[model samples]
Target: MLTDVQLRRLTPREKPYKLSDTGGLFIFVQSSGSRLWRMKYRFGGKEKLLSFGTYPEVTLAAAREARDQARVELRAGRDPSLTRRQRQAEAKRVDKQLQHVGEEWMKAQSARWTPRHAEDVRTSLERLAWPDLGHIDLDEITAPMVLETIKKIEARRAKETARRVRQRLSAIFLFGMAHGLGRHDPASVIKGALAPLIKGRQPALIDLEELKHLFHQVELIPAGGIEEPLIVSSFD
Candidate 1:
């Protein structure tokens, strides 16, 4: 058994050495004068070392308890090192939410985009995509769910808005996948399914009578408050 006094009294030599305790737990004293707690064990016909912690910060009793817990895990046919890693990974998984990850992706890409474009990206996602997806986890989203979300925008006669939203969704999913936050890009496969962007549809005033009526209405407007320039906008 390693005592607190013995641990404190341990001095570094020219080379690193180990002071073994019960159940394969030991203190590794390095030449740089750092004492690290470690355990030696075998799992699946291979030897592996597990670290408890450094001396003083992790006391002798704490080290023994950790070693005992690791032994229990090992007896259950589990690898203690891998179990620790999994717990660590779970604790670090704070960006599982789609909106959170999307915002993060936008911020990361913002420097490459114009300020107006970045704001537009943020607005489009928040307005058209987030109500359906913001609360959901990245991995939980499906292609059908994405389609449904954009379909609402298309139903509003906003096909152009829907196209932009879909493009942004694909970019967000791609960003999530590239960063290991999601399994796949659900939006990438459905680009062709959206309502097409319509341009230059036939004017509502298709005949001479309707054109004259529209001109009459325009004449009734009070002159020159930016309305004339707006009304006379080039077709191009």
Candidate 2:
């Protein structure tokens, strides 16, 4: 067993060396005077190493417990080193969501879209959707969050615009999923969730009398002024 008194007496040298403890754990003393704890083990007939932690900060007892835990994980056919790396990679992948994937999807679609339309799509997201959803993790976004955005647009009497925004968000989510940025499209669950659009009433003359009355009013414009000709010709 490695004693605390012996550990405290360990001094740096011209080169790095390790003082081994039982069960593949060691205290690696570096020339720079940093004593870090390390563990060496084998999994699947391959040798792998794990770091328990540094000395002083991580006591002897703590290092031993960590080594025991690693052994348990190994007994269950799990490589602690590989598992740690996989978890780290997954965390990194999950962080690249929403804005990151969205920008990438837009770049890919730029070739297929007109410049004006591409800009319109970008503007819609930046001005409307991004404020709420841009920084969110792709998988973490929910239908309620997206619907709230649409409802905000609807509250402004922009029902058609809200529908278009929802469609864009859905497309972005799908794009993210295809590229592995998200697991599922949250917006897919809600369709027709926004308020229905009310079409505007068109103006029309009710009868011949109304039509003739409009024509009569037009004919009353004073003749020969530049504005009169322009105003009269506008009705044509």
Q: lDDT for every model?
A: 0.79, 0.77
Instruction: Score every model by TM-score.
Output: 0.53, 0.47
Tens digit per residue, CA lDDT, model 1, 33-115: 99999999999999999998899899999999999999999999999999999998875565777888888888898788656
Judge candidate 1 against the unseen true structure and give its global Cα lDDT, from 0 to 1.
Answer: 0.79
**Lowest-lDDT window of 10 residues in candidate 1?**
227-236
lDDT by residue for model 2 (27-55), tens: 99999999999999999898888997788
Candidate 2 residue runs with Cα over 4 Å from true position: 1-95, 200-236
Q: How many residue pairs clash per model?
A: 0, 0
For every candidate structure, what is the RMSD over all alpha carbons to the true structure, in angstroms?
A: 10.6, 15.6
How does model 2 score by TM-score? 0.47
- At residue 68, candidate 2 shows an lDDT of 91
Model 2, global lDDT: 0.77
